[model samples]
Target: MMDPHDDVELSDLEDDAFIPSTSRAKSLKGKSPNRFLRWLPPRMRAFLENMSRIRLVIITVIVFILLLVFISYWNGRLKDVSIPKQSLALSKELARNLSNTAIPEYVLTYAPLVFLDSEDEFYPSDMAAHVSNAHPTMNFNPVKDAPEGLTLDNLNDLNDLGGDSIYLTSTTLLTNLPNYLHGQKPDKKTLQTENAVSCVIALANKEDGILDAFYIYFYTFNDGPRALGHQVGNHLGDWEHNMIRFKNGEPQAIWYSQHEYGAAFTYDAVNKIGKRPIGFSAKGSHANYAVSGAHDLHELDDEIPAHIVFDQTSQGPLWDPTLSAYYYTYSSTNNKFEPANDKTPVNYLYFEGQWGDQEYLDGVEGQEEFHGFHKWTSGPQGPIFKHLDRKDVCLPRDGGCIIKESL
Candidate 1:
């Protein structure tokens, strides 16, 4: 036995026996990196493998936060789409009619100025003249406000205590004021005056010739509402217009200006006398309303707008050309229309400058270079007088526009 054991070395004798080694078993049980984590750092890979649930929760939370931020930003830029029922119905009809109506159709072969001479074209002139004369008698002496003897003949002399100009012209205020005592507030007897600014002579093309496409212009001195203390955009002047589009001696569409944008309705949808459509201007903003409660899309204070309903019992100041002075020029040769006759109150068509002072801060978010109820940069431009097919005739900017496609 001793001889046989000696022939086999001590290491051979140990391998033949069954040996238990803890270190060797542990090394064989250790895990290797899977294909997904092969590129990661060794320590990071080990951490991720141990804390997979924690990492997944953190990623989900980060993604949710990013989604919330995106939603908030999206809603901040969204515009209001609330339109009244009658307005909506009229808008739909306009879309339907526009589909059948071909653009650039010359419908008016003759001048449409003849329509203005008839009673059907506008409201009664005597009534408008009565409204112009109806105002509260001067109560407060404005000598301190207007040191220049308060002639009040010019709009420039009507600055308030804060130096902000006002447009509330009364019979006693603007009529070469015998005294300087126009009050600040309006009473039950006081009636606001609406002025007829200008008119547009548009033509639409037809198979035979051209047709009547008249756009009548009206304006108010106080654009902002009395509420907000006239804080938003209490400018001195605001211009609102209504467009009557005609085809083959028949009224086709009526466009009303409401702030920066407006709506077009089929002629049948509107209340009209022959070819002229009725328009109601709100009290402060002087925005055109097709029907009662018909308001602008962006009006924050809807109630502030003149609740002027245009009907038999309730009527807005229908633009009476006889009571209000006007100036216009149209050249068929050049196909150009412009404000003319310097005798009119505002010879500003050629001014190409702002009407009011720029007193507000610059670079403000919405206040920058924008008209508001308080401060205004410039008076509105005259209505566009070119054919609808012309490149320059755009919506709201031209006071009216034609729909070439579905709105």
Candidate 2:
């Protein structure tokens, strides 16, 4: 019967005083902390709400680990598809540009036709593709201020940055056996086509119209032979070669690289497919030889027992390296490589570094040493260290160049 506004205010105050402060606080705490949980099922929401902080963190970490594993698996698959295309493109470009150069006709005519073993998995690799897939490193650590995207054209830049200590470390783990590591398989139909694998030909003009032609072959992975039930001497990169000594445009002698040492023979002594010499690449090691059979490594060093360490070779698929190759003239005087085509990359030739990963320690994962022998060893240095400018047919370290009369 009094003022209506006064009556309403008195009723609101009475209602608030009826509820205790503790009871109101308890009601607020009972509500879901996260509004998103409202969309979840009742049982699931309750379980998550009751989970301890430590349990929640452990579950989160497991989920994150699973996600990372899924991403890595797919990433390797993507590389398998992309690497081949990249290699093919580089092969085609090198072949196309080769036409512009004035490479001697005899160089191609006498080039060694390599025979890869029938059971061999690894094949000839492309240098440009190799450089593209690797990064410069020093002592297993990334080189500081190194080139962002290293390529064959600028490979020599690393010589200044890290010099002999630099390593062109592969991006993919060597243990993974990536497709690129298998390299370019020779196709009979594609041997003469743009799809052919590329090789390196470095010519050294000697005194009195003498020409020493070096045919270098690259492989992404070197499969070491099993010794005493353990794989020993395995490495990430391989460089095998053959050097032909010619006088007055005629072949005189040929040399085949095998491990640290190689064999040399008169040009007429080796088997020939027409004017081209035939070389057999060892089953897995890719050591070039003039004939097929078991090649005794002890022949180079008398200290090792004969047949204890040997390479097996056979006549398998023929690989014509001349079909696709990079030609260059090496000047021993200045120790420089001059590419036939201006577009050909020569910087890589000057690189004085290892082409693969350094040797792993015994305690490192997947690496071991048995009876003073390591399962894995350091990769071979680039062709530059192969005595490219040597005056004799054999490497300078060989003391005297032994020219074998037969295989």
Candidate 3:
């Protein structure tokens, strides 16, 4: 016999050898949940994983739309408001009618004054330092003897004598003009100029009799840098003003502008130690602070941590309030101070020119960039019309007097 059972066992062994070892091994399971998802319940993990990413995108879009609408509402407010036209007309008429009269001596004797650096020799300390360092040979004040033939008639021609600009201190003449000029022309290197700074008188009043309020405005011009320190963009002409408000012939408030907006100090608010308001014009910025170190963007410290502009010395120019000043109605048609028969100088306001050398771009190394785009480069727009009609008077809306009316 061939042994059929043995042959059957042999056939089974051959079949097992032909099968791969991998096939005999157990099958591997799928990957487990990530570490983050492992902490959640299995059901919760599944729910989160099923969320549509599209929903996130939709929510983001909705939030952006809401933000856009919020911005639009605020921007619209700036454009919607209209200036009161009747007020403007009233102011113009008031300016023209008062042209003939002089600023009352009593009003000038009592009103407070806002002091500025004299265009010539009497510069603030910082400016004096710069002038001494930069132009050592040049005499800041060169006149000892007052030049004759200087008048409002020939005042506009002051620049013809090498003066960079003129200030109208009064419609008449400044008797003290000689004091502000160069010292007797003793030096050949001195800054050459005939100081012909003048002034115009105007009184803004609400009515003819028993005046409720009056305004006295002054004008000045600067030949260079215009600001305190050696800031660039020094210009040829700068016109600035200080306005005083009188109620019942008493000085009620003083307005000293820095750039466009300034502080309005009530008669009681300022330090009466000097018998007038004491204001400090910042060293370089020239923004007048009610007190030393009190400065802000609009000269209002409504925001905390205001921009504190420091003066070179806490003790600065102190002006005499009792000094004579005037008020005048403006005649817009003739560009004249009221009382047109009074000789008016050439309408220097009409000729707009660059007040100084071109704006400077190069700043000293390791210092803030002093580009030419400063206010000095624009030259000063002489005392423009400001309204005393409302305590909230604002010219160009964002600027000018912002004193809230006492209701």
**Candidate 2: stretches off by over 4 Å:** 1-102, 190-197, 302-305
lDDT of predicted model 2? 0.77
Candidate of highest TM-score: 2
lDDT of 3 by residue, 222-293 (tens): 322222343332332233334556667766666655555555666666643434445444443344445443
Q: Which regions of candidate 3 are displaced past 4 Å?
A: 1-101, 114-201, 207-233, 273-275, 284-286, 294-313, 321-329, 332-335, 339-346, 349-376, 384-396, 399-401, 404-407
Question: 39-112, model 2: which lDDT tens digit per residue?
Answer: 99999888877786769899999999999877755532211111134434544564565656656667766878
Give the range where candidate 3 is weakest over 10 consecutive residues by summed lDDT.
129-138
Per-residue lDDT for 134-180 in model 1, tens only? 22112222223433322213323333332222223334322132222
TM-score of each: 0.39, 0.73, 0.43
Candidate ranking under lDDT, highest first, comes to 2, 1, 3
Report how far off residue 267 is in candidate 2 (Å): 0.4
The lDDT of model 1 is 0.38
